[model samples]
Target: MTETGAAGASESPRPRDSATVMLLRSVAEPAGSGFEVYLLRRASSMAFAPGAHAFPGGGVDRRDVELAPGWTGPSPQVWAQRLGVDTATARALVCAAVRETFEESGVLLAGPSTRELVADTRDEAWERDRRALLDRSLSLAELLARRGLVLRSDLLCPWSRWITPRGQPRRFDTRFFAAALPAGQQARDVGGEADRAAWYAPAAALSAWKRGELPMLPPTMISLRQLAEYTAVTEVLAAHRDLTPIEPELDRVDGRERVLLPDGTTHPLR
Candidate 1:
């Protein structure tokens, strides 16, 4: 462990459980591009991943749990098996994924029943609920129950997991999820922690990162690389994935700071 903060002072990393959603949609333009993934640039004033392009996510809320009301689709047991976590944790992750996706982006992955999905969430009432959720004054379970809706857990696909390296002031054990944008719904910049939000083709985002035009954390970069491989949203959701968690290691190589990935590749720290 580096045992030092970004300022070289000894600091212990406190990793929080988080869930991120990769929202994908099919686009007709740009001939070869099949899909676009939503990306949000965190406000520079934010405490974590400032100014970095990332997926919609945040730490799991205390109220996010298996006891949530009106959950439909795969059971928590199935989610537990897929995420390789306890049933309770699996439930929370799923709830967090749905809640955060709605909070960060205006798209809601829920409906009045299992066979249906909420098509639009742009109304003022929806915005009030979103704000209440963000402020922690409202719980997902309560919102769903009040609205007579069910969480559409079937919409989420488990993709990957990554743990922030130790020694950083803040760290996240974030589970990545992929979901196709619901029909009749559009993602709008709900601007809070993020300065801007937009959809970009996976390859184009990677190119921007490479050119230093956009900053991306390793996990974001890796996830984008993975998404770039598929031509359609169905291909991504249909692909099999290994949910093994990844924790990069920091080491000194020839007196240079470097991060060693699980695949044994090393990326020099900037």
Candidate 2:
């Protein structure tokens, strides 16, 4: 653990539980990769990782644990086993993943039934509901119940978990999830915390990061590298993942501090 503040306390703050989704789509154009990932550039005014490109996600809402919406696919017990958490916490995390994806990306992983998905959410009513969700006026459960929809838990695949390194004021124990862009739905720039949203091939994103164009945190960079290995969205969803928690450590390298990943890679602290 790293010491912080003027008093130099070694205790790190407890990380807030958060969720992020790597929304992927298959592209017809052959470039660096056949699939592209959805990314949002966080608003420069934001407090944490401002101006950095990240996925569609946010901290889990407390209401998420209190409300039980219509659900499909794997049960909460199954998700608890997959996420290595309690049943209620697992349920909230999964709900938060879907909710944040919808709140940030204008993409909803919900449908009327297990066999069907909401095709288009571009209507004015949908926009109102999205805004409501963002403002905390509408809970995911309430919105789904009103719209007669069920959260498609099967659509999401747990990819990885990352904890913010000590020394950062804002810390998040974020679980990364991957889901395919459902058919008939499009991801638009639903601006809020993000100023811009776009799709980039995993290799292209990594190259841009190397060029210092697309600034990202270690988790995003590592996830992009993993995504670069797959040529199709189905491949990513089908791939087995080791969901071990990766908490980067702050280490002194050549007298300057650097963030060290579990794989022995070091990145300069931003």
**Per-candidate clash tally:** 0, 0
Query: What are the lDDT scores of the predictions, listed in order?
Result: 0.88, 0.91
> Model 2, range 157-227, lDDT digits (tens) per residue?
99999998876677899999999999999999998899999999999999999999999987898899999
Runs with alpha carbons beyond 4 Å of true place in candidate 2: 1-9, 252-257
Off by over 4 Å in 1: 1-11, 29-31, 251-258, 268-270
Tell me how far the alpha carbon of residue 102 in candidate 1 is from the true structure, in angstroms, after superposition. 0.5
Residue 101 in candidate 2, Cα distance off native in Å: 0.4
Candidate 1 matches the true fold with a TM-score of 0.92
Could you estimate the TM-score for every candidate? 0.92, 0.95
Best by TM-score: 2
Error of 2 at 164 (Å): 0.6
Tell me how far the alpha carbon of residue 267 in candidate 1 is from the true structure, in angstroms, after superposition. 3.2
Residue 105 error, candidate 2, Å:
0.7
Query: Positional deviation of 62 in candidate 1, in angstroms?
Result: 0.3
